[model samples]
Target: MRRGGAETETDDPTEDYDDTHADGEAVTEGAGARRARLRRGRRDSAWTRALESRRVRIGVAAGVVVALAVALVAYFSPLLSVRTVEVEGISAITDQQVQEALRVPEGRSMLRLDTDAMAQRVSELPKARSVRVQRVFPSTVRVTVEERTPVLYFEAPDGAHLIDSDSVEFAIEPAPIGVPKLVTEHPGGYDAVTRAAVTVMAAVPPALRLEVGQIAARSVSDIRLELRDGKTVLWGGATDSERKAAVVVPLLGQPGEVFDISSPNLVTVK
Candidate 1:
């Protein structure tokens, strides 16, 4: 009985070994589960960092694309893609000539057209007294030209020189409409007497311009007129040209060989 009790108090070796093994296995399983969780957390962290990096890269790339698109639009916005030309105040010069002078072709960008160069080119034309060019936004260019008008015709070595009221000689061409020829002894002399004679003739009535065929300026103080109707006018000087012209109109009404209106206060007829 004593031996049996002592044996009972002693544990079974196989059972003890089985319990220790089971406990060790449980602890090992727990440690392994914790290691697996730690490894999964590390992998998740790596994946999250990679996703963030990818997002940043995508954002930068999108920004670059947007910036490029805006830059392209801004760069090409103001370029002139179409062209329109308009000419105004041109009489002696043709519109086609003015357009050719501008040298701007169709489909050329308006921003590229050199306005100063165009104005300079148009001014090269002999008949252009003044030239002005402007760009009307988007597609139009406007050109305005002031043409020279003939005030008197003088005989030149080559032909007749057309003179304006300002005494600027333009060309030796035929007289324009409504302009009178002033035949003078000093044909090429565009001196003060010629200018004064032109001033006097301009004051004459428009109806009488073509009637007076020749105006001879022998001297500044002596101006003679040869009428187309075989009559003569002995104009004394350039004094009171308007008054002298007014007096000549009434004298022309009457038939006479010579009508002298040299003195505005006194008149003589032959």
Candidate 2:
């Protein structure tokens, strides 16, 4: 203890090594803690994404429900319901008659009303030549009908059938005053002779048709039109009826008992 007056303490080399090892361990622990924090953050992000996806699905479902509810409300609402039915373009059948025929489902929604079906039902009327049904927004249904016009009167065993220009026999009623009486052996549709006579009547001018008393067809080619005055026109067939009608008025000015304008090219007044 007295040899050199400062019998010193020995320097320990292991202390430095222990300190360095401790520092390295602390650094490694810090890095591990940081990695754990990063992993936790990743898990939090995945959870958040899943939650957001669930929310989107819920929102879409809610939107769909809302849309469906709106549609249903519109479908059943009184605003879209039919409150009145209007019948138009009808004369032979009154509006009341057409309404009775329609029997339109009152208080039903216009959205659900079948326009095509209503048109078909209205078309079943004998006098309806053409029909159109329209949906009037918010409370009305409009039905438009075209009434068939009788071009001639056809006598059948049952009664007098009013025939239209298209040779369609629409109704059985008394013969109209001005329309010509069509006489044929056959009563119904298969008669080409009746069809020819009707065609000729339709082609004749209205003024001239007023004077026509009767049309007789023994056969299709043997069609003849008799006037109210004691005169006759031998119309051979249904062909060139428009031309034949044009030839008639001017040819009638000549003194003639019979006008043969059937062959419009070679017309004869005798």
Candidate 3:
């Protein structure tokens, strides 16, 4: 490639290659060169080989299907159904009645039974204070009920209804043999004066309770008890009940028609 002057020399186009270098060696085209890094590692192990096998994949799928089939059979089959129900821990409500109240679904799987729902149904019985339902396994369900105990009886048009410690009117049966009637002028359940009378009756000793024929309360603070032997106790208010009961019992030993322990510290007798 001569230019415009006679003094210019032509350059060879293949002058960059060296004949002494082998073809395996790389020739750098730029000022800077870089080497690639290769990591040394072991071959794939048996665990990895097993994961990729067609037989292993098929076996896993079959296991999952069988497990699902077994679960469905157990949940829906009569073998796990409730064939028997037992009721316990009750006095007023009969065992048969408790079982009937439960009303658990017949032929239902024991494992799928909802104890809470069954207990709620049993709790509908007025006399049941607390209810518990348990799976007896295999094919049985057990219901345990705690019946409310009456502390006094409230007179109603139909009959006398029993009141428990929490002032709940549970049953309308005949008053228990020695249980006393409550007269509060306020006939409703848990009336202020009625609660006071209940408190007064509860504080009375068991011996005195047997002697109590009826309890009356004119107001929340003025309560009276008329005994079976025609004696009376003037027990005022729900407060200081324990002390007044203590005073009334020992003083009842002395001859008195009216045993006043309204003020326990200064008791009076008439």
Candidate 4:
């Protein structure tokens, strides 16, 4: 009993576990916190070093400056200059004519080329119905042209004047194939009968136009068509040209020497 004065070590398992577990958890948490601080310290030191160095800041700024300078040189210098002028969609006019109209200088920067001015210049060509001008990147300028197509032709003292759908006399050469001749007392652009005849011609389908030999108009209201054969068509005026053209084609197939479509809604064949 006298030995009780000295405290003896207990054999209980939970006591040893409780005491050691707390110490172990505390040690693990301290180590983890120290590791995280070390990582943050390393990152902050690297950032501070970079901020303190004038060369680093200058290097980034110089890189941005160099990139911008390169871009400026590429845009203004001859590196991205136009080296070729390309013309497309031409049958009556030559490429040389279009290129001359463009008049863009060689080695001119594509960015500096005025596309609208170029298109306007090309549109001055009588044969050009529509024109588009654009810069083909890196070395070329492209000119796209839509040439006027002749719907009819009229004989003049000089030559055969080709008339397009809009009554414009675009060219004065031999009439193209399948183009019907226009016969009017005054067969010029300003003539009312000629314009009526042209309107009738423009409304006729391509296949029907091929079968037609001549179109005659006395006044704006009196128009006629002479087929390749001896058949005749009495078409009315420019007002109902579209409907007359539509009715006359099917009426021609009927057994008749004359087809009258003056009133398209009431057609007659004789």
Q: Which candidate tops TM-score?
A: 4
lDDT minimum window of 10 residues, candidate 2: 13-22
Q: Quick one: RMSD of model 3?
A: 10.1
For 152-244, candidate 4 gives per-residue lDDT tens digits of: 898989999999888889999999888889988788778788888887887887778888988988898988889899899988787877777
Worst 10 residues of 3 by lDDT: 33-42
- Highest lDDT: give the candidate number: 4
TM-score of 2: 0.74
Query: Residue 81, candidate 3: how far off, in angstroms?
Result: 0.9
- lDDT: the better of candidates 3 and 4: 4
**Clash-forming residue pairs, model 3:** none
Which is the better candidate, 1 or 4, if ranked by lDDT? 4
Q: What is the C-alpha local distance difference test score of candidate 1?
A: 0.77
Q: Which stretches of candidate 3 lie over 4 Å from their true place?
A: 1-70
lDDT of each: 0.77, 0.82, 0.82, 0.84
Error of 1 at 178 (Å): 5.4
Off by more than 4 A, model 1? 1-82, 105-117
- Candidate 3 lDDT by residue in tens digits, 1-270: 456665664365433433344766656432121111111112345556766796888999999999999989889887899888888888888887787777777777887888998899889999999999988878888888888988899788999989888788888989988888988777556587777777777899887999999888899888888999999999888899888877778899989899888899999899
**Per-residue accuracy of model 1 over 1-270 as CA lDDT, tens digit each:** 158456444453223222246447532235456567789999999999999999999999999999998766544555654467889999778998898888885665666677899999998887888899998976889998998888778876788888876667877788876576766666543587888776777676777777777787777778877878888888878778878878888887786799888897788888
TM-score of 4: 0.74
Model 3 has a clash total of: 0
TM-score of 3: 0.73
TM-score of each: 0.61, 0.74, 0.73, 0.74
Candidate 3 lDDT score at position 100: 79
